[model samples]
Target: MVDAFAEDEEPISLPLHASSDEIGRVFNEHAERRSATLRASTERAIRDHFAEAHDGQEPPERIMR
Candidate 1:
């Protein structure tokens, strides 16, 4: 049997579905954020989610693997 402790595979790259025009249109119609600020806010949200989920905990060596 393969070892359970063996190294995990790396993550795959995700594809974003929006074209420039489509993204611009959506953002313009809905979001109150400018493009640069929207990007920063999105990144901050992701970081916050990860931080809160993993806070004060010992994660697996390959937690998301």
Candidate 2:
């Protein structure tokens, strides 16, 4: 997962006149957006998986002993 954004750490060779702080802020925002997306996707996947796994399943009866 760390490698997924390793490229962001490297300097951008573009000739944009933005300051280093501005560039850093942009990268931070992009990273935050990506993290949010991943979290939402993971939550959906987990919910779907658990729902399918429990489909048509019943709880065990309690013992009276």
Candidate 3:
């Protein structure tokens, strides 16, 4: 499954532009967007999962794992 996910993920390359600050800002923005997306997706998944559980499904582990 891990390999399958890896295969499905699009390859990305971080290319630096002329300004280091601009590069950092771009990277930070990318990270923030990704974090927001993952947060929303996990929230939805957990909501569906715990909709049946008594105490609410165990909240998803916060770790990167």
Clash count, predicted structure 3? 0
Off by over 4 Å in 1: 1-33, 56-65
Candidate 3 overall lDDT versus native: 0.61
The estimated TM-scores of all candidates read 0.34, 0.61, 0.56
lDDT of 1 at 63: 44
The residue-level lDDT of candidate 2 at 17 comes to 89
In the range 2-60, model 2's lDDT, one tens digit per residue, is 34354344454434888988888877877787787667776677677767888876534
Candidate 2 Cα RMSD after full superposition onto the native fold (Å): 10.3
For model 3, state the Cα shift of residue 34 in Å: 0.2
Q: Which lDDT tens digits does candidate 1 get at residues 1-65?
A: 33322422333333398687877776564433344455666667767777799897654443445
Compare candidates 1 and 2 on lDDT and give the better one: 2
* Model 3 residue 36 distance off true place after TM-score fit, in angstroms: 0.1
TM-score, cand. 2 vs. native: 0.61
Q: Give me the candidate number with maximum lDDT.
A: 2
lDDT of 1 at 50: 71
